[model samples]
Target: MRPLIRPKMIVSAVLAALVLAGCASTPEPPPAPESTSAVEQWAALEATELIDQLEALPLDERPRDVLASVRQDEVVVSAADGSREVSVPIQDGHYLSIAPYLDRTHDCFFHSLTTCTGEMGNEELTVRIVDDRTGEVYVDETARANDNGFIGFWLPRDVAATVTVTGVGGTAEASVQTGAEDLTCLTSLQLT
Candidate 1:
């Protein structure tokens, strides 16, 4: 003669079991497969982003007659933007003179590839020529600003020299041989 259990007790037991099952949540799936470490992932993402940017860059947009020519110390450089011609006035020794063109509110710091932009006022520029073969410093001096925003100095008597200019934003340098004329370096400088 087993006694029948109360309906309330049965309901409570069922509820309790359900609560227990709910509490025992299924183990979370193993962390999703990570292809790389955090740093590596970041680097990969950056590279991919850069590649995408490069791919999206436009090759041709500006007019071809932008720079007719650019000159530096008896050197004339031709470009689609404009032209620049330069000459050395105080080319005594260890000094490479330069002139940069920029907007009224911006100053130009000497560089081979791009000029650094600074405040509205003019800035004193420094020039240096290094001998790559001997790892020796040949030319080093400070150049004063000219009325036309041009500066000048003399390269050391070294055989081959690399000139460098540093200013506010960045630095640019180019290598040239003595008496090299119409020195145009970059064939195509574009993101695309």
Candidate 2:
């Protein structure tokens, strides 16, 4: 008897061929262009100019000073735990205070078989200050909180700067502007 071809086998072969052909004939689409806002475009331009200026300078010679472009009466302080916006007064020769607290939490799993505990503290924080105009690191030191749970820094008149604080709890950053006229204490920053 002549060998018989099964209909199911023919159908399976045809299906397999169709799938392979479909995959082989498919073309990948081009990547989409990145969308950017007006602010982003301006920032990109500024960054490019900065890079070019730096590249032109000699290896040992530092780049030109970058003036503080943005001025604010307040700054947003952020940390891993939380964030807050603190207002700073435009006054010269004023002290800025920051207060942070410690919080504790515990987690238990599997009927108390597994336990995890953590503490967040804002003590002996590493604080840094940068001069925006000159691109210089003005201060980098550890700030110890007083008994009242506050850390203070003196600000010079007519200066704009960025401050960064880091501790076991988290980290925070802010930009501030000092008044042109010398004045007494007026500004404070609180982070928790």
Candidate 3:
């Protein structure tokens, strides 16, 4: 019985050693550097140049609610055409105004929940506006024909508002508040 116990003890020690060897973690290789072709580099620089030029223009000349950043993946579909990706970002309680590439668009049309577009014509679109604070509606008007496809309306400075727009051809929504200054705007994006 003692001799049998010695052999069992030796086998147990060997098994423990094998288990420890298998538990060792392997070292990972360093990540490779990002690759950028000449064309891609040039395109990036061109985009930067365009942004700089646009920044130099007066605020009025710039597109309304020009999204500085985006938080969620967005899909913009057109009944006439196909679709595109639009990632719009915002600060807290801020909204965006989007032009569904449709004829009717305005500064406040696409951004808050207070308003939404009701109907559309060959060159016109309806919009509705909602007040975020009291959950009251502020506007529900169909806009006149627009040369541009869309426009944006920001919250009155420091005021909270949410706006959403939906129709068969398009849909957009955002949360916003008038920020620190009278003209500053902020927004947030939510996925459903």
Candidate 2 lowest-lDDT run of ten: 108-117
- Which sequence of candidate numbers ranks them by TM-score, best first? 2, 1, 3
**lDDT, candidate 1, 20-50, per-residue tens:** 9998989779988866432232223332242
Sort by lDDT, best first: what order?
Answer: 2, 1, 3
Candidate 3 lDDT over residue span 49-144, tens digit each: 422333334434543332322112211111122222232223233323444433433443222211223123223545566778777775566654
Best by lDDT: 2
Report the Cα lDDT for residue 69, model 2: 21
Q: CA lDDT, every prediction?
A: 0.40, 0.43, 0.39
* TM-score for each candidate, following the candidate numbering: 0.33, 0.36, 0.31
Expressed as tens digits, the lDDT of each residue in 56-157 for candidate 2 is 333334312221121122211112223322222322243444443345333211101001111222258777878789877767899664433334465555
Lowest-lDDT window of 10 residues in candidate 1? Answer: 183-192
Predict model 3's lDDT versus the native: 0.39
Off by over 4 Å in 1: 1-96, 100-122, 156-158, 180-192
